[model samples]
Target: MALTWIRTHDWDAGTWRNRSACRDTDPELFFPIGATGTALDQISAAKSICAQCTVTRECLEFALATNQEAGVWGATTEEERRKLRKSWLADEQAAAG
Candidate 1:
């Protein structure tokens, strides 16, 4: 499936954020400063929260749609999202063709 829903769906039209597992958690947990040591722990912790989230798909879609360049969203780190974004854009282009 595509990582983005922005093309056919309104990114801001849903209240899925209200149901996010990280809503009450520290926002900084998702935006670690580095990719190793403490940052890896933080990323793991954040992804754990995302793993239990019911809105994970929506969260990922929103992140991809908005080009979120930092933090963990939908159990994925920045690097993971970048790769997924590339594939998603490719899928979008292929579908358009």
Candidate 2:
């Protein structure tokens, strides 16, 4: 049971398999990483693709639940979520201790 849409978006979603999407591989392809701005630009490109995805909500939930500390999930970048998760973990540890 394979979801075609998910597979198609797999490349744009920055999945481990998609790391090369922006990088040309074929001997015939000659693309350049010439986007304006800084690293935010890369995140923006990935987010733009995720925005139109049908499974954005599901992706977001999975990311938060698994404490995913990498990649962009939903509209949130890994760095942004990392700070939030770190704060939550610290609070939980303090409460438990």
lDDT of each: 0.85, 0.50
Can you give the lDDT of residue 46 in candidate 2? 71
- In candidate 1, position 94 carries an lDDT of 83
Give the alpha carbon lDDT tens digit for every residue of 3-67 in model 1: 44555556567688899999999999999999999999999999999989998888887888789
- Models 1 onward score TM values of 0.86, 0.46
Top TM-score model: 1
Q: Write the per-residue lDDT of candidate 2 for residues 41-94, one digit (tens) a residue.
A: 666767766666665654654565567766667556766667655654565456
Model 2 ranges off by over 4 Å: 1-38, 83-97
- Lowest lDDT 10-residue stretch of candidate 1: 1-10
Ten contiguous residues with the weakest lDDT in model 2:
1-10
Which residue pairs clash in candidate 2?
A: none
How accurate locally is residue 22 in candidate 2, as Cα lDDT from 0 to 100? 25
